[model samples]
Structures are given as structure tokens and as C-alpha cells.
Target: MEWLMYVSVAIIAIAFAVLVFYIIQTLLSLKKTMENISHTVDGMKSQVDEISKESTQLLHKTNELTEDLQYKSNTLNSVFHAAEDLGHSFQKLNGSLRKVSETVSKQADDNAEDVAKAVKWGSVVMSFWQKWKTEKTTKQADPGKEAN
Candidate 1:
């Protein structure tokens, strides 16, 4: 009986020792894994911070580009309007020029016969004036000259 009691006590002691050893090993492993997880989480946080800063800069750049584009678009719109106005002015000038050209052409057509008659009369009058002047000058040189 005493031997049985001693053996039972020894067995119980061995089991408790094994259980304590495994518990300590598991706890240490869990602690190490937790530390590794903490380090990984800290690295991820730093990367996230860098990404946020880049994102903010990108947003600012995008805003600046948008504003610049708007300004250029406005300038282009005014230029387009100016071009349209220029086209209208050209159209009006062309119409006025055509009217003046048509009037000139019509006047020329109506006066063609009158212009010809006037030129013929002018030539006849010039010849008569030349003959009269020569005859008077000769008469003045001689005392009495009859222009036959």
C-alpha cells in the first residue's frame, strides 16, 4: 500500500510538471508572435501615413490643373467670340463693297454713249480754238491780214 501511494504521488508530480512546461512554452510563443504582429502593424502605419501625404499633394495638383484649365477655356471662349465678330464684320464689308461695285458698273453702263459723244465734241472744239488763235496772232504781226 505504501509503495502504491508513493507511485501514485510520483505519477501525479510528473503530469503536473509536463503540464506546467507546455503552458510556459505556449505562453512564450504567444508573446513572441504578438511582438512580431506589433512590429508589422507599426510598419503598415508608416506606409499608410506616406500614402496619405502623397494623396494630399495629388489632390492639390489636381485642383490647380482644374483651375488653370478653366482659365484657358474662358480665354478661348472670348477668342471664339471675337473670331465670330470678325467674320460678321467681313461679311458686312463685303456686302458694302459689292454694292459700290454694282453702282459703279451701272453708272458706267449708262454713261458710255454720253462719254463717247463728249470726247468727240471736245476734239472738234480744240481744233477750232487752235485755228482761231493762229489766225489772230498772224493778223497782229502784220498790219492787215486776211486769213483766206
Candidate 2:
């Protein structure tokens, strides 16, 4: 009976030791896993910070681009307005030229007969002046004798 009691105690002690070893091993594994997770979380935090900075820069650049586009669009609007004004001016000039041309045409049409009559009167006066000059020269050249 004394040997049986010692064997039972020994068995119980061995079982308890095995259980404690396994518990310690489990705790160590859990600690290692927790450390890995902490490192991963830190890495993720750094990546997030970098991404946040990049996104902020991207947003600022986008705003600047939007402002530049708006300014260029405004400038283009003025150019369009200038083009429209030039077109209007050209149209007005064309209209004025057309009106002047039409007036000249109308005046020429109204004065065509008067112009022809004036040309005919000019020709008749020139013929009379030429004939008078020739007669006077002939009389002067033959002053000593009567001219036939």
C-alpha cells in the first residue's frame, strides 16, 4: 500500500508538470503572434500616413489645375468675345462698303446721260477753239494781203 501511494503521487506530479509546460508554450506562441500583429499594425500606420500625405498633395494639385483651367477658360471667353466683335466690325464695314457702292451705282445710273452730254459739249467746244485758232493764225500770217 505504501508503494501504490507513491506511484499515484508520482503520476499526478508528472501530469501537472506536462500541463504547465504546455501552458507556457501556448503563452509564448501567443506572445509571438501578438508581437507580429503589433509590427504589422505599425507598418500599416506608416503606410497610411504616407498615403495621406500623397493624397493631400494630389488634392492641392487638383485645385491648382482647376484654377488654371478656370483662368484659361476665362481668357478664352474674352478671345471669343473679341472674335465676335471683330466679326461684327467686319460685317459693319462690309455693309458700309455695300451701301457706298450701291449709292455710287445709283448716282452713276442717274447721271449717265448728263455725263454723255457733257462729253459731247466738251468735244464741240474743243473743235470750235481749234478752228478759231487756225483762222486767227492764217490772218496774222497774211496780214499784208487779204486772206481768201
Candidate 3:
């Protein structure tokens, strides 16, 4: 029995020693993890700040681009208006040209009948002249040749 009591005490002491050793090791590992986390947080802070600066620069550029685009669009709009005005002017010119063509056609039509009447009178006069010339030449050709 005395030997048994000694063995039991030895086992309990060994278990306690093992528990204390493991607890100390776990605490040391936890401290190392905390230190690593702190270093990582510091690095993240610097990266975030750099990203913020870049974001600000990008925003400024975007604003400038927007203003430039607005100005260009306004200029394009004015150009479009000018083109539209030109189209209207050309349409008016075309209308005037059409009107002039119609007037010239009407004037030519009005003169056509008078020209035809003049041509008819000229033909009648030409026939009379031809008859008179034939009679005069026959009378003057030989005086007794019985008509040329």
C-alpha cells in the first residue's frame, strides 16, 4: 500500500507539470499571434491611405473630364444648329429656283403661239413671192417663147 500511494503521487505530479508546460506554451503562441496581427494592421493602414490618395486623384480627373465633355457637347450643339439653318436656307434657294423655272417655262409657253403665228404668215408671204417671181421671169424670158 505504501508503494501504491507513492505511485499515485508521482502520476499526479507529472500530469500537473505537463498541464503547466502546455499552458505556458499556448500563452507564448498567443502573444506571437497578437504581435503579427498588430503588424498586419499597421501595413493595412498605410495601404488604405495610399488608395485614398489615388481615389481622390481619380475623382478630380473625372470632374475635369466631365466639364470638358460638357463644353464639347455644347459646341457640337451649336454646329448642329448652324447646319440646320443652312439646310433651311438651301431649301429656300431651291424653292426660288423652282419658281424661276416655272416662270421661264410659262414665258416660253406664252411666246410659242405668237412665234407659230408669225411662221404661218411668213410662209404665206413666201408663197406669194414665189408665184410673182415665176410670172415675172416668164414674161421677161423671151416675150414670145410661151412661158418659161
User: What is the alpha-carbon lDDT for the whole of candidate 3?
Assistant: 0.97
Each model's Cα RMSD: 5.1, 4.7, 6.7
Instruction: Give the alpha carbon lDDT tens digit for every residue of 62-141 in model 3.
Output: 99999999999999999999999999999999999999999999998999999899999999999999999998898888
Off by over 4 Å in 2: 1-20, 119-148
Q: What TM-score would you give candidate 1 relative to the actual structure?
A: 0.64
Instruction: Please report the candidate that would top lDDT against the real structure.
Output: 2
Whichever of 1 and 2 has more lDDT, that candidate is 2
Give the residue spans of candidate 3 off by over 4 A: 1-7, 115-148
Worst 10 residues of 1 by lDDT: 139-148
Residues 1-148 of candidate 1 have per-residue lDDT tens digits of 9999999999999999999999999999999999999999999999999999999999999999999999999999999999999999999999999999999999999998998999999999999999999988988888555644
C-alpha lDDT (0 to 100) for residue 131 of candidate 1: 97
- Which is the leading candidate under TM-score? 3
Stretches off by above 4 angstroms in model 1 are 1-9, 112-148
RMSD of 1: 5.1
What's each prediction's clash count? 0, 0, 0
lDDT of 2 by residue, 8-97 (tens): 999999999999999999999999999999999999999999999999999999999999999999999999999999999999999999
lDDT of 2 at 9: 99
Q: Which has the higher TM-score value, candidate number 1 or candidate number 2? A: 2
